[model samples]
Target: MTASPALRPSAFTDAELIGSGRRVAEIEAQALQSLARRVDGSFAAACRLILASHGRVVCTGMGKSGHVARKIAATLASTGTPAFYVHPGEAGHGDLGMITDKDVVLALSYSGESDEVLMLLPVFKRQGNAIVAVTGRAQSTLAREADVHLDVSVEVEACPLDLAPTSSTTASLAMGDALAVALLEARGFTADDFARSHPAGSLGRRLLLHITDVMHAGEDVPQVSEEATVSEALVEMSRKRLGMTAVVDAQGRLSGLFTDGDLRRMLDDTVLDLRNTRIGTLMTRNPKTIDARQLATEAARLMETHKISGLIVVDEERRPVGALNIHDLLRARVV
Candidate 1:
């Protein structure tokens, strides 16, 4: 006889499901809290070993632990500690050559007895590299052989089956994060250093992009003499399409600036003799300016705060060197 259709489990009420999730969250939080309390001299020792290493930290593990190792290596590398992930299985074949006397090895195993990981100890030792073991069992061979042993033991797995790694992996990842932050703080790593490492990132663009890099130079910069007529200055502004023109003296030093706003005020006041009116008479003299070497973001902030759309880039002697507008900043991604 054929079996009847299997009955689905009874649906849980929303309240009951919420309570179950809350309990799991509380239990996992407590587990992490307990793990934090266990950190002591061993954690410090591991940091010291990694900090002293002249070469990159080579991280290794198997299966689930292997995923955690890759993340830990990336975190370390991004936070001033040079590190790379090397699969233990691959290391046993030929990748062991990546480990050098100047490097430190971090091996992870939840059971503390992964055969593939264990096979790498002899090669690491022979290469004269220091080992830091992250495992749940302090008495395990991997932990016992390590120069510094970090205990990542958890009271229980979050998995209901008690087979898949859950709380244990969380503890290991948190511990790895802690190690990376501690090393970063101890090294006094600065934002500029981080920007150098991540030049293509947003922070790098904000901190490293200079005004000279994006400003228009030479003839592209709108300029007129102090004696030039208002009509001539207006023509120059239109030709350059910069919305303003720098007014300079015979010595080439900036005397003033005539902008679209100034022209509007002049026309509103019924100044009809544009050909007879000198640009210096209608210009804003000695306007706020910036050095060519200043960061583009700083210039953007200055413009934003002053409610201006453009700025004249100047040299040490206040001579017009370059010019930039809001469009330049937007194109450079400094806005």
Candidate 2:
């Protein structure tokens, strides 16, 4: 019997794999760069069309392009632009009603020849809806029927077999991101606006929630007179469980603060006459404070900047109204 060809490792090594990866990177980079150059008057016109529309941006596609369309719709919606995705196959089965005259349609197809997508073009046109097409073939049926065509053609597929949608999908996704960002800039979408869109997110807690929302109010605020003994202040701190107690004057304004760190320092120096020593003698004078109306994130920063764990929340009259610590911020998800 003829000897089977011996299996042997070639001299070709890791460098070849890395080199192939670099080549693919270079090609995709070039494709994106070409896409950037294609952003001309048409890009601005597309933004204007969507911005002026009263209805939502209805995004639709097939296969991988459909996945990209869904993501783009989500991004646009979250960035102050109303948008939603409609699968082309589903559109034929009753989803077509989602599109109205006021809506603008964004259709994605790599070959620009998806039958389901083409079938809906006449309906969209008859409804008086504006259609924007993202495709590799500008001359394809979908593109030819569209009111505006965005060319997202790539030089070649990243797949070695040249059969899969790889670089094309990346380019399309990047283009969609570019559109979202451009519209965001044009609409002057601020961080506050983004916070409103994501009220349950961390950014919302940091931006929208005030210090009063998380601070301990009423009986929870630990307070002691300036003339009170150190022992009395310590008892108040223990009762409040905030690691500190505010020392107030006869006028009920904050005068100083006594913290656990202060107690430790006092212990290291010498035993104080707790009964005779006033809390004001050992407290930190003019302690850093925050307004109740201030953002919780600002309160957190103040604590970090001063290297302190807690702060006394005060009103316009400089009276202690509440108390907050790092733990409160953590619990509130503002940190």
Question: In each prediction, how many residue pairs overlap at the backbone (N, C-alpha, C within less than 3 A)?
Answer: 0, 0
Best by TM-score: 2
Clashing pairs in 1: none
The lDDT of each candidate is: 0.90, 0.91
**Clash list (residue pairs), candidate 2:** none
Model 2 stretches astray by more than 4 angstroms: 1-26, 201-204
What TM-score does candidate 1 reach? 0.78
Q: Provide TM-scores for the models.
A: 0.78, 0.87
Provide the lowest-lDDT 10-residue window in model 1. 1-10
Give model 1's clash tally: 0
Model 2, 15-108: lDDT tens digits are: 9989989988887888899888988777787888999999999999999999999999999999989999999999999999888899999999
